[model samples]
Target chain A: MSCNIAIAGVTGAVGQEFLRILEERDFPFSSVKMLASARSHGKKLTFKGREYTVEEMTDKSFDGVDIALFSAGGSRSREFADAVKKAGAVMVDNSSAFRMDPDTPLVVPEVNPEAIKDHKGIIANPNCSTIIALVPIWPLHNANPVKRMVVSTYQAASGAGQAAMDELALQSKDILAGREARCEAFPYQIAFNLFCHNSDLKPNGYNEEEMKMVNETRKIFSCPDIAITCTCVRVPVMRAHSESINLEFDSPITADEVRELLSTAPGVTVLDDRENNRFPMPIDADGKDDVYVGHIRQDESIPDNRGINLWVCGDQIRKGAALNAVQIAERLV
Target chain B: MSCNIAIAGVTGAVGQEFLRILEERDFPFSSVKMLASARSHGKKLTFKGREYTVEEMTDKSFDGVDIALFSAGGSRSREFADAVKKAGAVMVDNSSAFRMDPDTPLVVPEVNPEAIKDHKGIIANPNCSTIIALVPIWPLHNANPVKRMVVSTYQAASGAGQAAMDELALQSKDILAGREARCEAFPYQIAFNLFCHNSDLKPNGYNEEEMKMVNETRKIFSCPDIAITCTCVRVPVMRAHSESINLEFDSPITADEVRELLSTAPGVTVLDDRENNRFPMPIDADGKDDVYVGHIRQDESIPDNRGINLWVCGDQIRKGAALNAVQIAERLV
Candidate 1:
């Protein structure tokens, strides 16, 4: 028996990525449904060489579906998660609405595949930056328990959704042609420019995007005591997210040990070629599934061998969100 | 009498910036001689609305010149610094050649203006990334001795020179038009991509750019014992360099105290507006002399407020190189 799948918000950036990933993996499916908001109704999308017309998502849309991948915003998930559950479908949500709910398991299949078995008809995907960062960290943490983590992210435009990605392209074109780059999806021009994440600021001066990273890592790791601080900045890249991470461990760990651990770890590719001065670039990780890890070195500032630094790049839309959700669905099967 | 100035490599990016900065500051000059490689000998460069023909730099170029500003790469500085000095000219060298020399003072006027008095004949300008990072750091270091510094830089194309900047513009247009981007001046496409600084990788795995930040910072701060580690990456920006700096202090220091100390610090402008999510961006710091400092927050990973993080942006050609060299000239005057 094959699973019957439904893709919510199928016309969006992550939603489109879900369709591509599903086809690339040759996911076993008896039937597929494409659903989106009314604005995208009657839109045509192709899956596995089969064209499917997009349907307006409603309470009854998930009937007879085995798994529904939701990439709609948080409010849409809040409105339809119960309906998907009542229709006997497992909802693998890519929204932030249910991620922090204790009842809903937040899963990254590589880091915590067992969490999928505990889901109560709905599982939440961790934030894109968090998923990309943890794919490398979880393996190292397994080798040596990290006492503290300092992360500074070079995030991409796709995190803000399809409109923002389009804005980057359009603004870049305009600016190159000597026209004033018009800002729409972002508060400022995103072409050849960077900014602090535009998320709402918290009382502690950390933006919401940064806070999500801090909170989501704890939830996925199931370790509430990990000391984490992050600075998230939106850069002008199209899709991939790059992070510079400083990890302080309780015990000393060498760069070679870290490399050996990650070499055997699932969903990680090592690119630490110091001789060639090559490390992970977001362009290299743009459409790849694995987290590109490199620039592994000892933090000289900390004389102890306990502090190590690394650079990571992963496609935010694929591995960070859509592919991760689809991987969780595979685990459920 | 006004100082007679000779600008070496006057046709290059930093050289042009030096001319603009001189005009903007209304610098007192008896005569301005523009000099470059033999290939640029006939090129005309305008300064203060008067066009000056670029001269092929030779040993005689520094004769009758009070201060010679050298920016024509390290080899040229090594070949010409002694001649300029022997010709009774003070060489404000902007190359890496003499920066680490014990007898040649590396000066960031705001951080170490007193060091200028000890310059035997040549005063070396610190690296652009180092200058930008140290402006705000020195004040904080003065307030509380920083035990460690961790720096990650998002550098601009101007650091590479005029050809690289032009390539960024050209590659960007080609990519937007669905054509393949041609890579030159850099090992990879730089229009929409970034890479580790192209400087030769050292035996310690740090690039020349990163080593400059480490070594030059030590010499300028007169704190050779302070621990420092840096990772420098070149982004797609046309000008200006931004750095993410994490400082570990011996004792706990509050974020409020950092803001207060930087508010009065020379060559620093605080842009920390958490409510509005406004912080320093390269676009905001482009063509500006003061290093823009913001994103000031206590790193929560290190409890007790021992770690403070900040972001800085400064015009590389201005404060990082040319303006800094000119400031040394002012000290000579």
Candidate 2:
């Protein structure tokens, strides 16, 4: 059942997380090919207690690789998709290149494992924020059909990459010492401050990151008519992303019903403790595999009691990106 | 016309903001009195380049004051309400104690200046988050009334007081040095983390802070039928509070139309520039009197285009509290 694995872009943030997740999950891989750009060629990376040299990925790099996990940028994924498919390797892409392609199935294992069987040599991974949200939302949607959703995200630095995380720490140190913060990875100072999500704005005024949540949720849930609007903001946290979500269902639903359903749902941990005033927070989800859901309550503004609010947090590096891709790869084996 | 002014709770964060705002605006005052609790008695505070001694507030403290600006805690404001009223001084209280009182006018001067004229000696300042939100919303609502709103807040540490701001700075230093962040002013670490607003949770599962935005917005807008829901989270920012707001109006409204109405609105600065992706950030509103409104766009989910989204930021200490109260006081003069 073991197959050869090729990890492209092994030097970037999600690329590094891919290595950690693959080893942590003990995936049955016969061999792992560490592939990167020409700049990262000959660089060394350790995987599963073994040292491997990073090789530059090219048209011929996927000769015998059975499963090529790509966390490279969108352009790299698109450039190498044909090569991987020609070599008979299944490409599980963590990029926006093929997510909306009608032929390439977008998968979140917890929510849409069945979509993997329909993949035509290349399966696309959903966006980090979309995956984090749908992991908890899918179980509830199955019970009482969500009619509309309004979401606001408190995203962390990791979603931008390792460089952004490092910039946050450096900015914190510089700001604390009364020096000006250096802004390289982000357009604005991300230390003790936040701004709207830095993504290309669409003609409709929604950013690409926000639209991914809207479009990908419909693709993954197989429900295209559900109305959704999202406002995404990048906050100062370094690892995990949190969201404040308000949902209107087809019928009346209660907070207790949501808690009861998510209590045993896969990949969800209900951390709601109303009496102690404890709920989901980024610090609680830093290195966790499960998406923490809390602050579940009936939306008081909806007089019919058909609306619900949830506070959700999950590690953007783990559950949001790398682990999700690994989970999809696990199904192939 | 010049009138005597008394600033109660002169040692608190909002109290200090009151002094700065008054001086910056050149508020006409025949006499200034600095009053606080016994703990702050004899403390020296400088206003308009003159040092004044803090006096322990008592029933007689408001004897000759024409207007008393109260930023003390709710209980202290309640304790002195009668004393200030008995001495013929109009109380512009910044606590929640009297905001919903039948005879008190909860005012955001920019939104509801006429309400100030109806006050029975006590004109209450709305919550900081509410004041910041309504300043921009009021202009748009006047053009076409807002029927419903969904809001999520990114509040700063200054809302909790000066000690909380200091704690955020201290926590950032400790965490950067690889030490545990001290948790005294907040229930959890707030250096690079955020949590649900620390206010007591109501039976409806909304915290007091969220409900304040709901209730106070209704009172100030004088539209009890306007449905609202809010999720408030405290971030690590030092001064300003940011909000992501979605509004559904009575009929169709475009982003450009809303922006045109807000361009000349008093106490509001439109900072939206989508091409450069420069929207309002907390740092942009820090220590500023105007609430910065940006990210103005039509909510794509609503097909008929009755929905609009806004990103807003305002100094929680200035426009949210002290300056708002001072503006009300100016109206009286």
Q: Considering every candidate listed, which one attains the maximal lDDT?
A: 2
- TM agreement with the true structure for every prediction: 0.98, 0.99
**Which DockQ value does candidate 1 get?**
0.69
Colliding residue pairs in candidate 1: none
TM score of chain A per candidate? 0.98, 0.99
Candidate 1 residues A161-188, lDDT tens each? 9999989889888988889999889998
Q: Model 1 over residues B45-164: C-alpha lDDT tens digits?
A: 778888899999999998899999899999999999878989988889999999999999999999999998888889999999999999999999988998888888888998999899
Candidate 1 share of real interface contacts = 0.59
Segments of candidate 2 deviating more than 4 angstroms: none
Per-residue accuracy of model 2 over A161-232 as CA lDDT, tens digit each: 999999999999999899999999999999989999999998877788989999999999999989999999
In model 1, what is the error at residue B206, expressed in angstroms? Answer: 1.3
Error of 2 at A330 (Å): 0.4
lDDT assessment of candidate 2: 0.94
